[model samples]
Target: FIVGTITSGYYSINSYDYLHKLWLRQLIITSFHHALGFLPSYNILSSFILRWLGAHIEDNVKLAEFQQILRFPSNLLNIEHGVTTFGRASLTSFTMTKEGLCYVDEIYLGSDTNLGNGCTIMPGTTLPSKIIVGSLTLVTQKYASAQSNCVLLGIPAREMPFVIPDDTSVINDLSSLNSSSIYSLLFVCLSFFISKYLFIALYLSSPVAVALFIHAILFCAIYQYSILITKRRSHFTYSEVITHQQYFLFKLMSEFSTFIGPYLSGTQLLPFLFRMLGAQIGSDVILPDIRCITDPHLVNIGDYVRLNMGAYIQAHTFEQRILKLAPITVNHRSVLMSNTLILPGATLQGQNHILPWTLVMKDDQLPPNTKWSGVPAKQVP
Candidate 1:
């Protein structure tokens, strides 16, 4: 009996030690990911850091600033050379089902693959080489057999009719900006430091509510000042090269707003803050998440419009390695449901109801008082 008890105690100690090590590793990885989001450039830094954290990221891979690997064993993640991600791609390596069964698996991205903004790459998924995944796509293991050089779109990300060209234009464009991007990186870091300093100073000297309000106002003022210095413009064509200070500052403001959004959301302060950032937000507009508006300066929201959580209004897109920008208009009394993506130049005429997870394509003009649904958003009764 004494021997059995001793053996049981030894096994328990080993189990505890194993769990403690795992917890510490996960904490370190999470901290790094959070810090990486604030960095202006993530290509080289992200690849190096992720590799150090046990991810198998290959050479010349370009990861977005906000890309994250959720719930690691990050060692299971493997990316081939020349993989690029445009915006935030969530690579989830772990999942639990309703039956309480937990699973962890590998996620593989082949060479020359491009992931669009807000896409989620699920565990056990294997993307082939030269694939272009559309924005907000959910890529699962079911599509593992998909062919290379094809476009994947929609919720489960099935193959589309488009084929990607075998050219180095995107890589070339990205390479050309590396040297020029250093200035933008420095500017972003300086801005972030100043903003944090301002917030800290105010917080230490005043009441919590007052301090937050003053910090937000000051931050917005600084953003506007930078915009003015950069000669803020409303439109940009696809042919234009956008390695400018203004673009970096724009991204900084977007990230800042998103960071503070949860604190100010569902309050009048949210719209007020967005107004200070140059958005034309109207009275009684309900913005549940400020992250919804990617480009506040180019978005015009009308009265009584309700934008649900995860409703993203993207005012820009990249085509053929070029940037294009346009304004988005959400007219009065319109309702956009959760997880809907409104693309550049989309006009939701007054009194429209857009359902959850719908994608309003670029330059679409939805008629008044209509109910829309689907990936490309056609009117549904």
Candidate 2:
């Protein structure tokens, strides 16, 4: 009987240890992602000095150079031994907070994953190799398992999985994929992003659009500031913030950012531009500003879909309670207008429209032919 009791105790300890490790991983990942966002603006001389002071830099994860403030919380952990370059970018990390608690560990970046301007990566993520992450994307979760060469967009990124088979490798005929092809692709992207109706249509009616823009901005600024204060006053290190319910809050915030930001971006020109400029965007969708994606390789945007201004779309959040993967989709020609938030694992079909100031829950679908508006947005006419 004693032996059995001892064995049971051992098992319990083992389970606790496992949970601890997971918590640690979560904390580490969260800290680096948050802190890196605020670091990009430091002058090279400053970055060098910081590095000389033993700053933890991750490999293949480059921070942009134009960042203004750099804040790494106390609980920062398990950073890889690699060079993180900073382009023109601003960086900021949250202070330890009661509301944002979770443990994080190592941030793994596949070779050559670049972080664009103003992009923020939250803790506990793994980015695959050779991916171009757009600017201003808020990334959270473990995406190390994502297929290489995929593109991710928005706050909570949805991976658009695409494979360039070995059979079609360019080395066999590198000349076939010449500079013109690259330019053509660039033109298509540029035209799609910069089309007159693309971002301009939303701005055509400037007054109401400006009001909505201000509303969205104020909401985000207030919320973000609150989160920052929570982090700073708590005395939690980057790693310590993810310990309890706070972890869940960050997960919620990350998911909320993903949903709200993209929904807002899906709106008309002004509001969309504001959110897109403020948040990170990945690869899949066409965003007005290229600098918004933090990890582009892990995002997927559907063809002919319009993410109107102020739309927030997210793919994944905290893995401790339940591992989740939620992606937002707008079918061909479907429009998700300003301030529309789509939660994890949502699907919207073509010709379907989500009107302004709407919030969509998880695992929900919008009928293709209808329009949805208002809080908890539902079909209207």
Candidate 3:
């Protein structure tokens, strides 16, 4: 009877092949995202529960119950006194094997930091006081800091130099300037102006010339944004509004602006685009010329930074059916090595050095001039 029932259900599902299959895929992704979300949320909830009851927690931190642990059946995750772990946050210790698989590892949390839901703190990471991290960040490093105030985000984290004012309770408008205003407008105009010039050159030249010119422009923009010093944190302008030429010239430039610059520049462009659309960025600092997959307006990059090659600076991560995006800021003079991953809604404080090929666990802090290395990146003397 059970087999007959199961067969009937299977047939019923198969009856609506295309639509049902799409629905099933969506459902599976959604379920996975929720399951993943539980890891951080569970640990944070545990920490909150103890805090509300006037108890302090310390040690054996595990984000979820279904996750495996040898020594203890229930993961004894704890948040030390005076330390705050926000709800819907997760700590991860999963590593990819040579065979292309992931295995879970242990995770720990330190002092004070405000973590939003769907945040991922990878294995071997530690968070210190006076920090705020946005949602859905993937941190994969052993990060630590004695710095009182810090902000971080990214798969492999980069530290921004600036911190939000403690007295400031909220950021109602993203355009609120932590730095300056005039500089911001200049860079934006400069970026647009450059794109416009390139558009004209390509217009006069052949299609091949257009492609080459775009490549040149993209490279120049990437180098400038990645390594130069500007007042604005992110320099993203919409090509659609920059030119009204309905012909192929405008379209070509728009494609280059939208696709080429972001992907080649090494910074995630979508986040900057969103931020710009919302008018959240009000500073004058500019990032080194880098190629972003999307536009800078979608993401939030911090002031004065160098984002090296192969680094994934994404402002948002797509999980399940939900799109959780955050602004990423690499604060003034902070250095991220090659191939590092910077996730959404993270700020890397200025003058911090992220060693090459290191993973920056989400929202973790590293003190200025501190040398760090390792898989879950750690401080080197």
Candidate 4:
């Protein structure tokens, strides 16, 4: 029964085939990706792996630690060198691994582009060379189309107040910037066991060594599992979105995201963490405080936006047998002051302002550069 159910669900997600597990090459490469892909740039291991996969990584390119950690599995890199100058951070592009058999095409990261920690450059995203993305920023749009020293913040990120990296990027990375090697993790565990005994029987004699080995293995497993979960969670599937059981699982992971997300607040890591959990974020947006994001995928935000404190943002409503989902577009250069409520399909045009305690309900459209306030958010003179 369980096998039948598993196969049926798999078939539903992929119409063409019921059993399309990852191919051998993909599986091996993916394992390595989670285990060691975060190695410092231009290192022999990274170069060797990319060469094996036919990646034409330029000699001038440098990859900082975790430069590709959060990158989706399906996204490939077209590496080149084009930086005008070098800085403290090694031009890091932390792309993680793909999910399912359908991988997206290669994405180009021009030389001299510096991405701060907790920033996500999604698949199909290309940034022009020399752009500086502030930390904790989420970039959904490709900058390869433009060249600027734009600093973006918040969800659905937008270009905001300009501040040089040397001045603003001094905060500690919200998450650990360091990555580990698979071999090192294994060796550490083996040494702990081996040091306690000359042979297998001797090793088993010490309960402390056995316990330590188990703990080490569990830690490694949790870290790798997190990478895997983040990859799958970020890539939305139809079945997961609509099916009640599947949606439950999706919500389950999101609950975990919510727990860790707040700690990343006001840092350069919150946006990346939020994006993986389902929010559609843009460049140079600021999110000092994020309200409840009931369903993040259903939200759409534009550039240069600021969502102030005490805001409640929702994207879905439930009643009877159907669940309704709609996108909320808060356009460019907008601000929602304290205690604002936004509902599904609410479209706020660019350069708009919402006074405190405003409620923008379902399907409401406010014109550009307008000021609104009230229980139902009426335009104010």
Best by lDDT: 1
TM-score computed on alpha carbons, candidate 1: 0.75
Error of 4 at 157 (Å): 36
Root-mean-square deviation per candidate? 7.0, 18.7, 16.6, 18.4
- Cα lDDT listed for each candidate: 0.70, 0.42, 0.44, 0.49
Off by over 4 Å in 1: 1-43, 65-67, 70-72, 95-101, 163-168, 172-194, 202-217, 225-263, 319-321
Error of 2 at 300 (Å): 26
Report residue 220 deviation for candidate 3 (angstroms).
17
| Candidate 2 Cα errors over 4 Å, as ranges | 1-43, 58-62, 65-69, 74-106, 116-119, 134-138, 163-381
Model 4 C-alpha lDDT per residue in residues 233-348, reported as the tens digit of each score: 33332223333233223333333334444665655455554565457777776776444455555666777777776665666532111235677888889888876667678998
Ranked by TM-score, top first: 1, 4, 3, 2
lDDT of 3: 0.44
lDDT of 1 by residue, 193-291 (tens): 765665567679999878667757766876776645224554443224344455455554554465566888878878888898899988998888667
User: Between the candidate structures 3 and 4, which one is better when assessed by TM-score?
Assistant: 4
CA deviation > 4 Å runs, candidate 3: 1-254, 257-295, 298-304
Worst 10 residues of 4 by lDDT: 1-10
By lDDT, rank the candidates, best first.
Answer: 1, 4, 3, 2
Candidate 1 at residue 275, lDDT? 91
